[model samples]
Target: MLDALAARAAGPGRITVFEPSPHLWRGRPYGPDLESVLVNAPPAIMSIRHGDLGHYAAWLGGRAAEHLDPLLGEPLVPRALYGEYLEHTAETALAALREAGWEVRVVRSRVTGATGAGTRMVLGTEDGQRHEADHVVLCVGGGTPPDLYGLDGAPGFAGDPYPLRRTLDRIPSGSDVGVIGSGLTAVDVVVSLAARGHTGRISLLSRSGMLPHVWQRPVERQPRFVTTDRVAALHRERGTVALDDLVGLLRDEIDSAGEDFAAFTAELLAAETDDPVRRLRAQLDAVDDHRIGRRFLQLTAHTVGPYAWRLLPAADRARLRRRLRTATGVASPMVPVNASILMRLFDSGQLDAVAGVRAIEAVNGRFHISGDQGRRTTAVLVNAVNPAPQSIPRGAAQLVDALAADGTAALHPDGGLASTDPRLHVIGDLAAGGSFITSSIPAVAFQSARAAAAVTAASDSGRALSG
Candidate 1:
């Protein structure tokens, strides 16, 4: 994203990147110690421009030293190393900008608040400092993790799986960890805990039995396709997808394409590997709602040609032929794995599934939770609970509420994702209303560019970026 910004503000302009976090370029999601959060898609899936291959990765992680590209296939790089690359790129960008007579300052301070001025911005810093800028880009990045929502006096849980590794070290070793959700975050916590050598037991509980698929390499390549229908397949746009139905639809699409959807997607990434995000977004822009009907079929069936015969449903294939394909609702029982770490825990009779976690209460020193199933015990209750976009925020919800009431921003309906015109931008998982299978490097870079452009325009117009 910084690269995109620098490229856009190539001419005479001043851009100040006000990042409060310790790690500026990498943001909070990519902390210093995160080395194994391998990107899922192929390198082709990443990009800034429509054809800029590996621009972000080349700048961030450098060319993959290995033959396999994690962004393209199942390769995983030390996420921390990626962070280093980002820092390096930011420095390089700063130097070039200075040499070219562009004014840029990367400040390390938390912006307490900002009021949008028509031609400028009034920004308050953490140390009670105040400043004005010609423009402001509110790249707040991801929000606090879903698990940290309601807990009080949470001195130490197992560890925060979010950005910032120092927070984890704050917790004492050998502490039993109670993970609230069973999905990816839960898995992430388990993996990180093991990495840190936390010997205490880790218990994971979630309403649904859903778990992410095991990583597998694609076997064969498929073809590009465009399905002209999709509304009926639009199920729970703001939440976890129906694993079985989603897999089934992709299975069918690949079958038609004469290969597995994964392989086909691999090929697509490889072909567009240079700048897949931009090209894909451009393609989506071209289609928009004009081809909503087609999008429905393409969403699920589209992947069928990508994933080989490894996983799918026979019933979905028959239904796609007889039914409108768009009529089938997109939700299905989640499939589990035999070798996954979470599955291994489940198999060990350590973790169990709860129908739903209704409320969390502080009973004595430990937190108590009640749900549809019943109550349970735990050493430390880490709220792995996913954020419910529709749910009302409690009394303490402050920043966003203040921002919305003051008319500085709006919310995207599907997930209440923060909406900003141009000067202000959101990135990472917190940004709403984008592709389901999205990446940060490219998609995030795209947003940063938009934000930076707005800032540059304001500075040129003798105005504020937030205006």
Candidate 2:
């Protein structure tokens, strides 16, 4: 996102980034991290430009040639390596802009609040400093994890789950650790802990108790069904796809699989009678190509997830949420290596699963977690649930909250905020009416480019009108 913004805002007025880190391009995902931390996808699909899918590959070839031996193939490189790529990308863009005579400053401070309006906007920082700008883009990345069980600031609870390498260190070695969710973040926590040689009982607790599915090596194939044009057609015809139509489209796709649609979907949604850990482990061992089915369904969702979300009536959205919300946790499966480590831990009796963890109460420097099935107490409890986009303020940046409070920004009916003040634009997960899969590097790049173009056009128009 910073790369896109820097390119657009170059050759003119100052473009000041309010990030405390000089290497703002790295963001949080690509920040300095252990080599054990690998990217979910390969180098091919990671470039900022859609045409240059191999840009990152080329970068790797020069900087870290060993990691790029397979050249055109997909290899999950280290996360920090990606960080270095981003820093290099940003530096190159900055140098070009400087040569073209534009001032750029990567300010090192937290933006406390954004006040005022329109072209007169003032972004206040923690040190009682303010920076004025004509347009503010709210690409502040992911929000804090929602306090699912109100465990914020508790002794044995961790609300913010990033830098798992450090946060997991607080847990005493050999102490039982209860992880609250079983999504990607939870998998990372478990994997990081095991890598650190923390020999302790790790309990993965959740309502469904389902971990992410294993990822397979990519096969070159375009989306067969659920094309974007189909979604556009629906919008063209009725302007909105009701909950029933959405379900019917999925059912149609399932029918195309040559199986009993009803039975197939039922089996898909049915709970595993066997232990989930054992099931995932067996999957890892057998390594079937069954991910094709999941990939199709996922691609279908991505095609319509964002637009369909906005078109739904408020009541329908709530119904859809109630039915499909929990399914999201297991939607995007984890990378294979991480899944393997988790399976190994579970097999070794060091890791466990607890179902229906509804609440956590801290006591005696420990956490007592209770749920529908049963209860358990653990020495340390880590909240592994990923941040929810719907929950505003709880996980949102303070600037977003402040703007929201004063109605400078308005929450989109779909999810994120829209600001009438200063034409504040929100994108990525923070943008309500966008795909839930924006966490992907490609998705972020695409959206960032679009946002930068929009910002440039808006700035140009403002200048023209003023002149």
Q: Identify the candidate with maximal lDDT.
A: 2
The reply for model 1, stretches above 4 Å from the true place, is 34-51, 56-73, 126-130, 147-149, 154-159, 163-176, 196-200, 218-223, 227-255, 258-339, 350-355, 359-369, 386-408, 411-440, 452-467
Q: What Cα-based lDDT does every candidate model obtain?
A: 0.48, 0.67
lDDT, candidate 2, at 45: 54
The deviation in Å at residue 213 for candidate 1 is: 2.6
lDDT value for model 2: 0.67
lDDT of 2 at 412: 74
TM-score of 2: 0.85
Angstrom error at residue 329, model 2: 3.7
lDDT of 1: 0.48
| Model 1 worst lDDT run, 10 consecutive residues | 329-338
Against the hidden reference, what TM-scores do the models get?
0.64, 0.85
RMSD, one per candidate, in order: 11.4, 4.0
Deviation in angstroms for 466 in model 2? 19
